[model samples]
Target chain A: MIRNLQVAPDHYLLELRLPAEFPCPEPGQFMMVRLRGRDEPFLSRPFSVHNFRMHRGSVSLEILYRVVGKGTLLFSRQSKGTILGILGPLGRPFRISSICPTVVLLSGGIGVAPLAYLAHRCRGRNAGGKRTSIIVYAGARNAQSIVGIKHFEAVDLRICTDDGSRGFHGPVTALFERDLCSYDPEKTMIYACGPPAMIGSLARILEATSFSCQVSMEERMACGVGACLGCVTAVKDNGGRIRYERVCREGPVFDIRDLAGLKTDPC
Target chain B: MNASGTFGFGEEFAPFVDLNELGALVVKGLSWEPRQGNPPPRIIETVGGMLNAIGLENPGARAFIEEKLPFLRQYDVAVIANIFGETLDEYPRVAEALSRAGGIKAIEVNISCPNVKKGGIAFGADPDIAAEVTRQVKTATDMPVIVKLTPNVADITDVARSVEAAGADAVSLINTLTGMAIDVESRTPQIQNVTGGLSGPAIRPVALRMVWQTVKRVSIPVIGVGGIMRAEDALEFLIAGAKAVQIGTANFVNPQITLEVIAGIEGYLIRHRMDDIRDLIGSLIEPDSLEHPHEP
Candidate 1:
């Protein structure tokens, strides 16, 4: 661990320096982290990669987390030298096809962590001659809850706070609704990660739209691996039949359209 | 073997593990009909363990035979179908369904699920019902029958004996113990289900003791389960008289843990100059039984 600092109230950004040979995680892939030598919180907590840098002899990855419960509260007090049992790059990552000319990244609260990495990757792809534009819509309860805004500096940024303390006074999806005319729905792909309510509303708004969208879901996960079957989300198969899919394995990232009538409550 | 419900019919971890290397693979608990399971917040991490209330959610036995069994048939691993029921009659029906499926190596009667409202732990909690379920399953199938006993019972040996008397080929001891966790600030249960089954390192000691007692009391082989995260934990169970062990909660932490455990046990046997791993079974020395015991 190198840096552990508060990026917002109750939220902290942790930078872990892993071995040079550590496999790099793709955008939207998450890591399961637990404090070394602690079993009070028996299972490791999952966190999406916020940023990463592979240097000459080391690889450092950043994780943005909030003190939502016991495991995270312990994470907030850890110092730079604390050892954490890390399991990684788990779950399916966000898929971006080159055919899509525009990518819309939407996030709520700490969900911004993975989208930040996704935005960075989009910028890198664009630099490599792929004609793609990036737009980020970030929403939070208040200014203090806003996170990862700086990572989206190069993209068109739209910020929304529920209390009207930030850029857009309404929900972030409203901005996407207002800007719907700017891009061709056929050429655009929207990726969202956040509270179920926010994602649910976004899904509802996109019902009549033709833009393809993917959502990164959050569930109370015990094992960030596929074995547990603890973190499952209901998804519709090709036959329009519902089946419980493990979020830790098959995906935390899934096509919004594939989720037929997803429940608004956390699973 | 990977315990029921932990390995999800053996398809999810196929990329991470070699199913052929396992002694057996116990698929998730199958029922007469598809079960939606408990509501959200079905699992939560506790001190040195985790609690789950999955309620045995499955695609039903017919769906299992159609969708999952064929995939499992590709592997050399002994596939054990862990069957459960919502009522007494459903047990034989589930077993008979698997019996006609033609590929399963054995049938594990799951009379130990604590998450359901009926016909699960309730059946395992009593000796007569446990025996009846075991007898019905045994009559319904020609495959080897293994009765998985719940640790939630007053005396697991009683349940073990009943299953043994009912002609069960073997028994799997120590299913998850019923437990609960509360969120202080929210002033509510952490899991949506008021109570859940606890399994992990925290429950290992209790499971071992139960396995030991059951081993001493019954004539059948015991498959020890509950928090066998490492090879050493499994060895403890083997020494205490378990014929085999099942890896459960630890599979969540590390998908390769089962293979690691197999390697570790092999290493220990090689270090001890043992040709066969069976030599270590029930090899514990009882200090009290020795004629000239050292007073410490």
Candidate 2:
């Protein structure tokens, strides 16, 4: 059941309260959602987990989405009691380890959804005496395009807008490059999720840096499971040979270095 | 039965549905070597249908036997290995390797995948090439060989008859129809591959017509597959002369659809006071004559 719906400038946040038995999703994991009794928007739409809360006997999950096409436009108008058919906590998730004491999250537009969840997880890990530091760099077209900004309040936040109407007056990558000197390169690990062009630019910049990075990808999907094999991303294996990995199964998250070539020319 | 490439080796959906309840489980398309498949944007949702250009991505036959076969063996349902190839010789080699592994119940030759660049739709489009493929696979393995035919052909019955003449035990029809979708706003094709195979409720009428035509021409059992989402859909195929039907695209929408279809068929038989389900096969009524239409 939908608990709350909040509208941002170009996007919306939907909060759903599910049964307690619903499995807890890790950061970067997603759900395939569809409106019940409708077949026009036939296939389910994939959404990253923006936030989730566990109550005594129930769980509430939040999804942050932009109104890009007909499906999302319809989702924006759904009422409180609207029933949605969902399938997930699907795909591989971001990995947080103590080895990397400084965590940096880079996002573009609605790509902030999964990273917000990761920042929340990093906070829990920090409370256990891990001494982890969380930093988020978020970018959008303009101030109005920025959504899900509140989710990162617990972490140090830096915002960028293309038109210079927000915090930093440039691409997020530019801000990240200027701030790269502050964090210890060896201790920092960057996690990014964003548009293909932004990811492409970041992949190029990371090649000269010592910090390691992981990226979450998006594609048109049919089956959330591996059956359809619809969502695939090209990646170079250890031998430097390119192979197609199903974004729905093998990953939505992969090491940035593994996707070296395809990041620039990804379809 | 679950069609190839629709059910991902039966393990992914085990949590939602019982595997043992299926008539058979046909895993994804396996090949002589591990295929990387096509690039991203491989799927798009159309009106009452969906398109895909997955390109038959799978671990090679050897890796499949080592990793997947063991998990499938635990279930009581028969396991059919759907094998594909890049060349004519690769077909027999893949069949021979699967035969040596010793767990597969049958070999369903996937000669109809349109997503690949070569040897899939190529062999199925020609009657002689389809016959040679069936004959080679039959010689390489003692397991029952079922040749899957594509609907893109000029005459699907000619391809079906050729495979049957080459000693195929049964045949499955109609693989996805070739189609494409475009994003007008971006002015680009929806699928990166430019074209893909269309599947879902939109193609059901075409599949039913193809199955009805092919069954009359071939002597072997026809396993109907194409956009079966309900028990009534399966009944339509059975009544049109298909001995059995495989659930494909519907598995993605609802994993339990196959089980529900099975129970629904049973319920149908009980409601009609019929003792056997086979009584529904080829039950289409005609006023002209009761004789099989395609017989010489």
Candidate 3:
């Protein structure tokens, strides 16, 4: 552990010095963390890599989390130099389809962690050398819950809080929906990560559109690897049959249309 | 040894674990047909353990042989195939299929999966049915048979002894305890299946007591399972007469746990000045037999 800083109420930004030989994690990939030698919380908790940097020839990882349960509470109390058990870079990364002209990054509360990393990747030009415009819509329950905005270098950054203490009033999804009129479906791509309700709202808004999108999901997991067969999310197979896929392996990021909840035909 | 379901066909942990270091790799319960298993919210973490209702989802016997078994064959570990059925007759068929595959060293009959409706715990809960399943599998294959017993029964020893009598070469006890947890705020069950099999450190003491009981009742070799996280935990089972120990939930926490446990057991032997592991097996000293209580 390098730094453990409380960025907001009930939220923290933990920095860890990754092993020199550790592989670089893609933006949407995650790490499973547990306090070294602690047994109260038996299983490790999965956290998306908020941001990472090359520090003194080694990788430095940042994890943004909220104190929602026993595991996060324990993580909040730890100080510098406390060794931890970390299982890395697991799950498939977000695939940027084709040479898109614009990328929309959406998030709610601590969900903005991974999107910040995505935004960092979006800052540069695409394979065709066409400059890609980046836009981020981040939201939270209140202003105190809004964080990680400074880490993003997006061309446009919109913030929304439930209590109206931040940029826009009401939900971030509402702000994104209001701004959706100007985006060209052929040139734009959307990526989201947030609370289930927020994601659900965004999914409903994009259900009938041709806009390409991917959303990251969260679940309580025993093993961050696929072996446990735990942490599964409902999704439609190629045959349109609803089947469970491991969130840890198959994806933490999936196309909006593939999720079973958004399937048009009810089985 | 890794308990079934906790270790997937052995390929998933290859990056972090050396499969050859394990005593045996027990694959997840394979049925006659590919099963999708349970729905969402299949697993939930409790105080010290987890409740899972994965419902024995696997790529049937044939698929396992064609796809997963080949990957496992690359590793130099003994592969124990754990098979189950929804009906009584399916047991022999699954066992016969795996036996024909040639790589599997033993067949561990899983008549104790609590998540399923019909053939799992139903057969294990009754001694006669457990014995019948064992007898049928033994008749169908030339491989050694090990029947896994459930702790969700009135008496695990009765099931153990019955299976032993039915020609089981070995017995592994005890499978997870049937358990459930509720989300008080949501006013609903934490697991989608309502009740799941609980495995972890919380069930260690109960599992230890049951393994000790079953060891005394059965003449065959007994393998202790359930919530064995550390070498000390495995040693407890060994001292209680378990010939082998299987680590389940701990594998989820650390993939290299089995290697650490193997090293820890060796360290214990060296510290105690014991030349052989058999010296520790069934070494439990009763209170009345304690000659040097303060010598340690």
Candidate 4:
């Protein structure tokens, strides 16, 4: 069961008590949720792993979400201590090894959910003298949309709002594009999540610069467990038959290079 | 309990029908997080059935637990948790979570989801994994587990027997086969998910066949789903060896179908002077065997 805890008005962070000794969800991994209340329109909604904590008997998942539809709207109205029905650790998680030292986490809007977890995972893994610098480039429609970065200590966070209300104007891409030119493409692996177009648009720019990035794709899924194939992304396999990729099963997290024809340019 | 993907669990249908009056209300599929589901134009209408690629857009298991279940508790229906996963491990983790739920009664393991990019077919299409998933869930929790089978498999019977052997309390069928509708004029698939599952009258015959095959192979009661529209349609399943029936596509057309079927069953019982609804179950006869197979 997940405990629906309110964060800010219209924003909520859901927490679930997973069984203890279960496998830890990877950084970019995600879960699916169904909001309570009769007024909610959508039956189920998906969110990336915000973070997790292991206890003596159970592991818990923390996911942050904003009410956008019938699902979130109802969720936001929920008071703390409200319980919800949940399914999770559903999709594939981002792959991280001890060797990948310098990491860049990117997001558009609330795409920061998994990226925040990624930063936490990376920070936890950084050993003596390894100095895994975490660079965050978050894009939002406005400054109010920024999330979770105020508390992160080790990671350097940059904000880009479309309206130029705060921080850098233009897009996160401007910041990301700037870093891409100066950063060591080989040592640093890019972990990204959010809406498809933002990821897709940035993917195009990344392709032009030969920067390797791993992307988490978003699809409206019915069964986040993969059998529904409702959350599918097109990918040109090695032989190049654009087949349907079930985001719930294979990934919400996938290798950007592997998505092939679904991504623009040589990517 | 209903299956995932085909129906958005019990949420959408509850509006038009009294959810608690039904036996159990199974909700939609759960992942680890919230999903946006498929792209635009997710649903497409056909002659008798509808094809959808609405991808399992859910709020992940955590969200469902935190935000969804409380609302479901408002209704008096037994909440059946419909969980899906990529591999054997996914089922147990979800089941364990659902086990802790306050109002949930049973867990419906969705063995028939066709939406995920990978790890989906490996479990649903394979008898070993299907059973393995059942075993895993049964071991993880004390709740009754129902393994919902997909119609896309080569041998639905083999999977049914496997789940039964693996200690599943009950099993359900048939989940929709992977399907698609193309917008020929636009030269693209009509559904955003590219290929969605096929449900409704188009798949009734297939569902009936699978249900017949499954019940014959396993003693566990089979809950038949797919293309169930009316009480007679529900009756067809009851006669075909189903102990109960799940109304899937019909909910979209008529949310009251489940109640209608329940009323229809009562009417049938009263009209025939049959004492119990069980008397109407497993009425399939092949002439060679006039005796009831399940009779004590």
Query: Top model by lDDT, which number?
Result: 3
Model 3: clashing residue pairs?
none
Which is the leading candidate under TM-score? 3
Q: In order, what is each prediction's RMSD in angstroms?
A: 3.5, 3.0, 3.2, 15.0
Q: Which candidate model has the greater TM-score, 2 or 3?
A: 3
lDDT per residue as tens, model 1, B1-296: 88888888898778789999998999999998998777667899888899999889898999999999999999998999999998999999999989999789999999999999999999999999999999888889999999999999789999999889999999997899999999988899999898999999999999999998899999989999988889999999999999999999888777778899999999999999999878999988867746577767
Fnat values, candidates in order: 0.59, 0.76, 0.75, 0.06
> How accurate locally is residue A156 in candidate 3, as Cα lDDT from 0 to 100?
91
What is the DockQ for all candidates, taken in turn?
0.53, 0.69, 0.73, 0.04
Q: Write the per-residue lDDT of candidate 4 for residues A7-123, one digit (tens) a residue.
A: 545566777776576568878887766654322232457788888888777788888887765456766666655666555566778877556577888887777777888788788
Best model number under DockQ? 3
Ranking by TM-score: 3, 2, 1, 4
Candidate 4 at residue A213, lDDT?
A: 81
Model 2 Cα shift for residue B121 (angstroms): 1.2
Model 4 segments more than 4 A misplaced: A1-10, A17-23, A35-42, A55-59, A127-129, A260-267, B1-278, B282-296
TM-score for each model: 0.90, 0.94, 0.95, 0.54
lDDT of 1 by residue, A20-137 (tens): 8878999878998877555577578899989988878879999999898889998899898888888888899999877787889899888899999898888856422456888899
Instruction: Evaluate all candidate structures by whole-model CA lDDT and list the values in order.
Output: 0.87, 0.88, 0.89, 0.73
Ranking by DockQ: 3, 2, 1, 4
Judging by DockQ, tell me the better candidate of 2 and 3: 3
Higher DockQ: candidate 2 or 4?
2
In order, the B-chain TM-scores come to 0.97, 0.97, 0.97, 0.92
lDDT of 4 by residue, B152-266 (tens): 9888999999989999999889887778877777799877668877787778889998998788899998999878767788888898999988877655444456788888988
What would the per-residue lDDT of candidate 3 be over residues B169-273, giving only the tens digit for each residue?
999988889999998989999999999999999999999999888888888999999798899999999999999999999999998998899899999999999
Error of 3 at B203 (Å): 1.1
Model 1 docking grade: medium
